[model samples]
Target chain A: MPRVPADSQTSAGFDSNLLAFTRELRAEGVAAGTAELLDAAAAIGHVQWSDRAAVHGALSATLAKSPEDLRIFEVVFERFFFRKAEETALQRGEEVAGKDPGGEQAQRIDLEALKQQIATALQEGGEGSLRDMARLAVAAFGQTQGGSGVVGVDVQRIRRSLGLRSEPQPDLPPEDARAEGVPRDRLREFEREVRRELERQTIERTRSLPPARPLGDLQRGLPTGQAADLAEIHKVVAQLRRKLATSGQLLKGQRQSSAIDVRRTVRASLQTGGVPVVLHQRPKRPKRPEIFVLCDVSTSVTSASIFFLAVLHALHDSFRKMRSFVFIERISEVTELFDRERDFKKISRAITSDAGVADVSGYTDYGRVWLEFLKLIESELHPRATVIVLGDARTNGRPAREDLFGQIAARAGRTFWLNPEPKLYWNYGDSVIDSYSEYCTTFECWTAAQLGDFVDALANPRHLPPSK
Target chain B: MSNTPKTAEELASRLTADGYLADTQTALVAWLAIKLGKPVLVEGPAGVGKTELAKSLSRVLDRDLIRLQCYEGLDEAKALYEWNYRKQLLRIQAESADSGWDKVQDDIFGEEFLLERPLLEAITSEEPVVLLVDEIDKTDQEFEAMLLELLSDFQVSIPELGTMTSRSHPVVLLTSNNSRELTEALKRRCLYLWIDYPEAEHELAIIRLKTPDLPAAVASRLIELVAEIRGLDLKKPPSIAESIDWARALLLLGADDIDAKVFRETMSVIVKHRSDLDTVAERVGVKLDGGDAASAS
Candidate 1:
């Protein structure tokens, strides 16, 4: 017969303890599936059984999919596999009672020795012998499998084998009869605390996230108020001025400098034999033309005004003369406001506050604004100055003074209107744009890019070269 | 150089030379659409490369681009004409007509009356025009309807006179941040392409192209790290533009390799939102350097 170690299995190659633990795990909700069992067996076969971390990893990988699942596995694995050391002491107590019948002292010595052995084994890793002693003690002392009775054993024998002193039994209950110590109220409070903490953390996390883009940088570099698309418009404005300068078409101030003005230069040249040479040089008349800009700064058309101002500013440089006015509720002169470089934010605030305007009014009143502009044009505008009105003509049910516009057109060298609103929305509101359209020499859509192109065409005289 | 079918592979190679990388078939189509005068409507998340296509097209074409940024209440005059009032008045005074009404009317509404806005200018330009209509979806439905004529005919009709048509047709390019839906009429008028975020290899190529001076090892590592971060649920995934910014930041700091220390210092370059940074910090087992200085350890 082959002798087996006290800690070894009764039958070779049979892990009876591990099989018992697996059975308990299956009884609980944990499903140690066939694959997991196979993997566990193979892992245990490869690694040293004492390495607990490796075992834990192999089992966890086989069983768990998420954090919640891992937590469940930890609880179930601990309950079924990590047996408590004090369990053997309870078994030893039952053994002493059964062998010695009514002997309490014998039971105390046996229990003390068992407790010492369990503590020693738990501290170190050589707990196989202690596990065997626990099993043997339970088998010998336990009556029937389900019966509630304590067995008896030789206390001195147990004490000498393990290492402990005699002690009387305290009022300890049986392991099965002992109630779980966790308080229901304490557990519920812990759960509530955890939920509140999680809610707070979620709120904080959400608050820390950034807002959507585009909304954050809406009008950063757009043309608005005083700061127009100057660079883009200058090229066009210069061309127009040069075209007028070279044409000698007697454009307003050009009449005084016309080569065909024989009465003036020729009369003076008679003193030089009518050669018209070396006559007292005729003074170059300043080409200071008047320009009126009627911009619609209504909430719906504010962006349109920025591009108009850009073209106006560029034209001002080319013409060296212009009077600009912005209108939403009423027309107000903003030429001085636009002379400097001001961004939309600053100019928008100033315009709203009635800054740089003779009068302050809210919202675009196209009819009233145009009437006011017509009054200024007839009374103060030089006949030589060109009158330009910029607006979308959406007057919001207000009267459109088409007759006043016609009168201004009659008095000035030319009266022109710029409508930023698309033609489709022309007749929808107080948009008397169609009525005013009759007075405008040319009406076209003026987006920022288009405004720049138009100004460049006006500025560069080469495109519209001076007449031969 | 070869007369092949110009596959996505070929386009990708060309884009690499131009300092861009064509990652997906959609991006390749977008690149081709731009080159071939087809309008591309790129719609995606905010950080994705919708608007960047226009900028890159400007660089690639080497043309003076005209951009018409669309928004609420964007109308024709702002997009197209204004009259020369001062010049018209001067003309009226110079003519000295006894019948001033007729003279003013004719003078105000003459050739001098016409103001060439962007659409008209692009149409009339002798040189090739790259007209970028940016963020078209922001404008109202009526605006979209108005664009049909301009996009189809490259001409605008002024009822006062007749249709003003283009002498030189422009390469019409329109972009939408997709604030709202655009009209079907507008969509039907042109060829469409959509741009998406780059894949791994293309993203790597983009980083290399953008930061040519960066060491190859650093660029590759940065791309890999950013790609990994994108996999996580982030508030703002690192865009191609952001990736370039991050790579540049790293190169500026003299980091030839991406490591925990370097990444911690330059987290802001790639991860814009505070929440995104926190989430990334937690997921990657790193410390949030500033503010609370909390450690994952």
Candidate 2:
């Protein structure tokens, strides 16, 4: 609860004060959603007007998610909502020197001057008894500030001057005979009444402040910027690459000296008097498979693409030569986008644009993209390449061009088709996944987790033999 | 009196005296897994006491911890046992003159030539071991599939050796940061728990416990302020470990109060990032001049 502005108002009786308080909560990074706000209002509505503790408890329960949320709510609520009379005095500018007489003016400045005189007297050291000091401080603060006077001294400050750190000393006699020139008992009664009223008013002002809303209720589904998630994706990928590099795999482009055929080495050693000797050996090169990736960049598959790009970036080091293309209503070759520092947004934007071969339209034309892909394959497909096509296979019920995919499958080492949509959505609408499934070595890629698994299988093909 | 306590300290103490290390909830979970005969899967933000729970549990329970750290490309051979090809080759070469191929093949692929990794070691150990599979979310699905049978039955299978069942049932604790949602099969095999940052009072108690020499006032103020910052929507919130660090920093500097000057000088104790510190400094509006007694109070 923060101090709300006096003039603020809301349709739900959430006046300027409440709005300002909620604003401060938001600024403090609490999730302060509309639902939590409505809940706070409901809780506040149920509480009795006089029971401050019940109101505070209700508001806390409505808003707080955890103990940490409660603690923060308490501090912020106190700072923002509690309106101390001392602050009221500061607003008046009466007690300090060079005071401003603007806005609201205090009625009696003489009482503040007298209180200052007594405080000065006490600071001058030992001139007055403790009773004398208490009398002077209270009379000056209470009389001047208490009545209808605008400019009155702070009684809490007077109590503080009387060596009372918190509340006034409980054991103090209420009488001040020397200063008031009255009977001790009578003076005591008057002083007690004034002290009680002052204490009551102070409590009323501070306790009337609203309770803070719980941070957890406010924080649910709060939008985290895309940059943060992207950075996290980057970090995870880098860590993955580092772990892979350390697993005794050769760094890309670093060739091994030779592959020692165990049988041949042993046979040569036996021929050379059973002693292992230098033997000429030709280097054995592991097959470097070419990979072609096609990704769907439709709005529905955007979340899936984020993970798809991360896996593609990670596998760049392992693959011999990789070509990537993304399509929605068009087919485009984005092999150059596989460079180490390519911007993801730029690639996504480029793939969805009309600058590519197939015409840009609202829905994918699988037949058009497939025909274009076939043309490129006939001209540029390497004998050792693996073709990977990723999409939901929705083409608005047009021709699926399954024959082109089948022909491409025949030329490549292996073909994989990945779909971000669930398997249940495969046969619906314009999706031709069922038709294209026959040509693919594997046709599965539903979640980001599955996408990563599929990419790893492609990059590290030693685990699985090449499909016929 | 009713038994439920409001404060974490009271709960922690009660749990501790019940023959459990109470403050470390993550470790308590791992210990409970052994008692309950269930695998524990703990998930939360990083540095919120996920992996440390496993480490602490190993110490508290007096069991050897077999740690299998998961990564993107971790496979069965890396997690379980792999055939020692070099050792097998040496054996084959040594036996070539005297032994036939059949005897040589049998000797090379024998259990003696198998190199046990973390998973295999946990399953084979005679003494009860705590197997900590750290950050399972980082690994691919295939690797996760490999752990499903092992985690559920406490057994691992090799093509040559068939299946190896646990000699002494190892208490399994798997941790993830939720980088990706785990397959339901893996989640179903374990008892799930989510560990969060401790409350302010609990953090204060932890500070006092870990750094006893610190002034009570300083620790209290540090806990209060750090608790305030955690309420903010920063990229990274300070963890409980950081609260202890901040208290120690204040004790070293001989400061008793939390003022703007001390806060600026020792901001690093609570805030690890520059941007987060800047945000905290702007939000905490009180100024201290080493003379503002009222403000300090």
Candidate 3:
């Protein structure tokens, strides 16, 4: 037999590992197609195999299509390529040794000393030491002694015990922070490092996790309406809008009625010696659905309302007419704010602070707000209009305006109610979802993915539920 | 100039010589684009040097740069090619009625009357050129679809004339602000690279390179302040371009360190928005003022 190449074994291993990694990425929603996979494989051949950063750059640029995909690609690449077998074996050895009573007592870490080391690391502002300290903290405090034969990592508990919750202590004076030569932001960075290590440990412990959107998993506990979250939502909305536009499901009827463009026709006639033999027509504009959004801007449902407004703002180009209203106890038309400000942050701020929507207490009053909304937009309501109501349906035990909601549903061609709370939490406390949900279709839109599905359905009128 | 970079590291150094400090990812993607004869789709926030990357690549490759600035109604006539309509009309009027239609068509449709746009020029050029399609996200989907033939096959099709393929392969770069999602078809034809805000050390090096006269200490300090400001959740973060400007401004002012008073004067060099200025002055201003107090004590 002919002699094989020197690095044949390693190269074969790398190829198989890369193929598995690409499949893992696809299962985790990275959108890596065959083209990207081939590009990644070809790219790896060009870079030096020993140079880790170069290899990472090549694979990342070839495989990851978007910034979101890049993030998932990085995490998977790290876990797959650098599993640290030695560390795992070492940890397993420790676990086996600590099974005995005497060894278990010896393995116990001093909480006070660990806390002191973290404080010193924070004050010194050395990233290397801080990261080492985070790993130590995770090793000592992150393990959960479950009653069942299972080991789990709890980063939140470690954060609390180390007094590094990513949120600065409100009572700590700025002067003290300056004196310590380390700001609260530095501590926050250290805490993030700890969280990352804990996540890695969890992944190692489980050996496999259910395929999930990495973004959804990371931002599970994050409060909504953050700028980054808004950006992510904006991207997803843009994708949905593109899909709806490309499908042409909504533009079928409108194509036949397109008016001829006179200017283009005249211009085209010049090429033919001024005789208008061939007529040039304008591209038919789609028949756009009219939209009216009545959003609850009360403190309880502020997050959901912000997201709704953002989604509608992104989809404004696909609609013929649109209007927005923000309400706490009364309705105030704030469509001008959207028209005036291109920045979402400014629009959100104006809606919450200076839009002058709240006429009474801060509590949500659905009955009065719905009555006022009907009075405001009753004349403008038409058969082609789609009315969307965004809120938690938490009326604070106020009178439910079932009749007013029914009138809205009757006047508008379609009515959709998007509640930010989960289905289980719908009728638990002061929520009156049942009172008004009968008049319109209701969707639980607590996450961006749910909002995407709701908008996708809204774009296709045939999928809309019948209004009662 | 005739020598292309043999490796990503070489391409990165060549780009640095042209005053662009590209990270490993950017350099690798660009090198692959050259080696594979594909385009690079650069996406990021505004003011992050998406356009500058094209200019730098053109300079590094020693090729003429042809730019197509896309907007809301950008069409084939503006970006690809356009007929000299007025000239065509004049020629038609000048032609005698006795002359046959074939003669007039042959004369007018020749290269003399065909007005080549940036895209057509990049393709038909005798020498290779760098084609930059800037802010492609602003164009409508139909225009993007029109570009698919040109981008994938390096050819343009005209109804008046047959398809024209490029003899010299031009390096192509398309930059988008990501205002909207581009079609997947366009993305599939190019290598993707996202150039985010540079890290502190990387940005410091950029400042040092761009403004050599600025003191190293002052440049590092300015970059530190910029990083801290970016840490805050502002509507618009100061980009690397703004950071370099601020460093030059500080050098021109002959400032040793960034104190609160000095910062207030030169703050506009970095922060542009009215709201951002207020926030930066409050958050970063306190740190500088606190520093002043401690030194004085």
Candidate 4:
């Protein structure tokens, strides 16, 4: 039998700080489960605690599962471990009245002196000193915009004054540009440190964690209307795709050709004296549902629509037919653009700029879009089509045209209205979700997780829709 | 006994001695995998030496490398173990009619009639081994699910013969190109190590170590140009392997300088895709032409 690894807290007593750090990582949307936490805690015993990078690596290998998670881990590691301690020290300085806290109270920075320090740090090429220089630069130059006390680093001002830009300036002579190469490269590192420091301070002051999503809660809903990074969204999309594809949910009501019917083949072989002469395969099922996606391309719901359309485009092959339409007031078919461009960003750009889907007002008018679709494209809807509407349902107080939507919904097999706005905000303002919910399935489509749930419900034939 | 490194720093040095310039993170992760007795899932863009890390670990630890190249339709019979059905049939036929039924059944199902695939071979080997599962993302979920039992327990179960456990603990490394997201169950059981492209300095050191004959200055220029080319929007960016190949090509040509002409002549060594050639030439060409002008002055 394989030897069981030692317990996470073997010799040293369990540190509550590590537990809190893992919680913070979870809050930031990393799926750092109990198993990973134990691994990380156990990993601490193997690495030297004094060597920060070594500890970081050990914890990262155990806790972070992907590059995206690693990015979050890097930010959280620096802030939670290093920045928190320094902040406490600064608070201690505050308690001591006039005594300086490691010279961190340099409010008005002398530009030339800071530049000299950066240049010296660059020349020495020591990462430790460069980090110290970043702290110094952020303390001296970082300002509280409009006295709100929200820490924002003034990177451009510092970089311009220090001549740290890498691009060759038209005014600067060629040799001068070449001479600034080393400093330019080092300045990028310095700027990264500044940003990290700024993030740490901002998070500290706000007393709230940044939007993080754990991957384990894909079926559960996410924070509504929050913008996630493209890569994170893509990861969630890929995971959802793998789950939906493998679970055979997408194969519902569709013909799957691979598996043979042994019983049927045996029964058919009886005609040939049980010699298995003619093998029989399972008969094909009914065709998969066609999908019609009508998305709101207004600025508020554009990201959600992009995600929705991207997911649809990815699973386009599984369905019988898939068509997409985008509208700001004027509705236009973007299925051709989705077909032509493989990248979601390009499709989003085309819908906004080149697809001629926007009106003069640039405001989302749900009634007008529905009316236009009803007039121009109602006949194209298949009887077995799944009509999905992706929007906030904020129709700018215009006529919601529930009658027209009901007509569209009655003609199709099923209709799903995904509102990017939170459920609490639904029907409070210009949102006509209450009127439309009576006619079709309505879901609060805020996060990618919710999108995955909606897709699951849409693909799984056994999953019944919510009661109207 | 296995020669696993006592510490991460020692592992780093050992890997360096094996000619794999692992950064601190890679070294620490690999060491922790060994220390914790877990598999390391190494993921990154293609050509970042994810497979090479497994090989270097095998060499450094004096373990035999047992590789399983995963592809589409990879299944239990190919990956774990397969019954030698033809041999079993022949054995059954060769047995005398007078032999008892139980004797014939046991004789055909014996170990001699078993064909050991990579997983079973690694488990059954007497010496310590390094199990490298390459391009794991290419395989589907069923294959991945089949691996979960073997990965977690280091054992495989054959219905006729029962479970076959490992004699020695083998170091396991699974490399992925991140083409698809692997199931969380597989990831949870393994230590994750993501190897992105190395930094310019690290790449320089790698070039120096891998191609000692190439002039250091020329290698630096080639790496810098390659970095520039990577910045362009290309279908396939030149990876570290391509960088080393470019360095070896330059050394073979006895080219001291990489001006626009030398770069144009040997650019195909790195840029593989035909569609990317125009874009790379248009973008990286400017850098080389500028370098040529600077050299002339």
- Give each model's whole-structure lDDT: 0.54, 0.60, 0.77, 0.76
Give the chain B TM-score achieved by candidate 2: 0.86
| Native-referenced DockQ of model 4 | 0.32
Q: Interface RMSD (C-alpha) of each candidate?
A: 24.0, 13.9, 1.7, 4.6
Ranking by lDDT: 3, 4, 2, 1
Which residue pairs overlap in candidate 3's backbone? none
Clashes of each: 61, 16, 0, 4
Q: What's the best-to-worst order under DockQ? A: 3, 4, 2, 1
Docking class of 3: acceptable
Q: Which candidate should be chosen as best, given lDDT against the real structure?
A: 3
Instruction: Pick the winner on TM-score between candidates 1 and 3.
Output: 3
Per-residue lDDT tens digits for candidate 1, residues A108-203, read 435545554443433332335444444433333332122121111122122223322122112333331111221222222322222222222222
lDDT per residue as tens, model 2, B188-283: 556556666776666776777767788888788777787668755466888876776787788888887877778877887778787777766666
After superposing candidate 1 on the true structure, give the runs of residues whose Cα lies further than 4 Å from its correct spot.
A1-468, B1-15, B23-38, B47-49, B84-90, B93-100, B285-297
lDDT of 2: 0.60
Which scores better on lDDT, 1 or 4?
4
lDDT value, residue A322 of candidate 2: 78
| DockQ of model 1 vs. true complex | 0.01
Provide a comma-separated list of chain B TM-scores, one per candidate.
0.81, 0.86, 0.94, 0.95
